[model samples]
Target: MKNITILLILLTLTFSNVSAQKIKDGETVSLNGLSVTFNITNKESVTVGGKNFDRYKVSANLVNNSEKSFNIRLNASPQVASNTNLVELDCINATGAKLTSKKMELKLKAHNLNATYWYYNKEGKYVSGVLPVIAGYYLDPGDSVNNNAIFIVPQGETPDVLLRKI
Candidate 1:
């Protein structure tokens, strides 16, 4: 019985360490009975096409926390920001407000025999010009995906992102 107690304590501590690896901001949302959260880390700004934009490095984590494997379709839009301030980074917004969708467009393509996806954006009306916004992810139980995106918002405005089941 003493040995069993020791094993249990070790297991508990192991789990605790795993959970502590990431910071939780209480930004959980329930999608089709699954617990999901989006975290924005490492935000910055850059000038593109004579204008400044907000860029974000983001991650979307889907936790099953259940007995069954769920087949889910997650729509993770990189260019779209959530209406909440959950994923805001401490970066200066050069635009002063969020850029409208018309001012920018998400450019994504699959490479390596369609094994990987690349993300970039075109600023202004010119096709030869490109900005940076890495956005692409899918959903799987106990899986996390990364997306980085640039928003057309000025400083002090954070883009809102959302996840939906389809």
Candidate 2:
């Protein structure tokens, strides 16, 4: 099962990278000397825990095309509401009436979780990015990091910001 899962993930990354290479314009952004490609391969909605949520699957590929090692920070920007801790889901149900959910907060927790995405170390081997308590990480020369994130957006009055980049 572990091997199958790894194979599936590798396939996903391979396909995503192929799509990333077809960007026409601003999808590729440069920071210092690193070339980061952001691609949104899928966008839709899903029902989780009886609530409607918009889903955005994004793949952020960071390539240290330069010769130096650099510490990179993936800052959660206000302009990108998808990266926030509290994602507002759609308040209305199928019939259009608003849902009166109780006032409750939920926190997600994980322990010793294996890395799911793809990254390359200084030795060029596939690995995972250093998981920080916050956003951001480091990149070494010839290293490539594929950072994938799924944004669960609430349905209703559309959010102030959508997942504009992949």
Candidate 3:
């Protein structure tokens, strides 16, 4: 009986440690020419560029340890750009989840900008207009290092933006 109890305890501890472990959904190596440290957690149903993403959440923590401000932009394509105004989607900060249908655009008047994405255009183009606002937080300088966004996959559309962090 004593041996069984000990084995059970060890198994419980191992399982607990595994469950308690935090898995990162995504990682940002560099941002805005500054080394950034941040992490995102609890992500699901992630699809980008018409591909079903394996990872649900993106968690990133800066390794370089640089304190700097950078601009982050999220853009989508294959869906023609229109004059239609972009709408803010529902978001939660603690969970780091965002849902938006429209594409996001940014006009950078400054030189300091950091953009990260899963893939880019053939010409290595970056999106400019129709930016999506998630969780009432705009990607800009002096934002939280643990920021996250969600780009909704348009119906019958592939080649979507999966993750973008700066």
Candidate 4:
């Protein structure tokens, strides 16, 4: 029975769809009218007005594939996943308040450039900028921007952001 179970597990893993495979670092996922490439980087903490902050940052390169201005229609919330399980980290506000959501979404309007998006700079502060993947920011067609999305993951836990399509 043990040997049969092991063989079954192997067969299941081998027969899984290619789309179920995890998107590794430096890989790009394209959907709808946008494409995203991900890379996780160490948090570079910075102090502002005597308060220090650090975060686990994931930088994503976003490309617009439409001929005109594009509005964000995809759910851009990222998940931290491991080999065995996928973890959902708590969503925190700028004032350090915990929220009920574990997912983040982006809602950019068409032709709206210079809009402040939710970007956590390398300095570790939650500020609005053009370099944000999970917020409202306009991207002209054929244009790409390296957006920074930071998470408030706990210390000592190395997290892998996973993008899975259902």
In order of appearance, the predictions have TM-scores of: 0.38, 0.35, 0.22, 0.37
lDDT of 4 at 132: 36
Q: Can you give the lDDT of residue 15 in candidate 4?
A: 68
| Residue-pair clashes per candidate | 15, 7, 25, 0
Q: Which one wins on TM-score? A: 1
- Per-residue lDDT value at 58 in model 2: 49
lDDT of 4: 0.49
Model 2 — TM-score against the truth?
A: 0.35
Clashing pairs in 2: 39-166, 40-166, 74-136, 89-154, 89-155, 90-154, 90-155
Off by over 4 Å in 2: 1-26, 48-51, 71-138, 156-166
lDDT tens digits, residue span 103-155, model 2: 11111111122335678888999986644343333446877755444445466
Q: Specify the poorest-scoring 10-residue window by lDDT in model 4.
A: 80-89
User: Per-model C-alpha lDDT, please?
Assistant: 0.43, 0.45, 0.35, 0.49
Tell me the tens digit of each residue's lDDT in model 1 across 44-161: 8766677766655555555554445433222453344222111222222323344523111111221111223444545434234344443432233454333344445554556544
Which tens-of-lDDT digit does each residue in 8-37 have in candidate 4?
Answer: 999889668423323345787776666666
Give the candidates in order of TM-score, highest first.
1, 4, 2, 3
Off by over 4 Å in 3: 1-28, 31-33, 37-40, 45-144, 152-166
Model 2 residue-pair collision total: 7
Candidate 4 TM-score, true structure as reference: 0.37
CA RMSD per model (angstroms): 18.4, 21.2, 18.4, 15.7
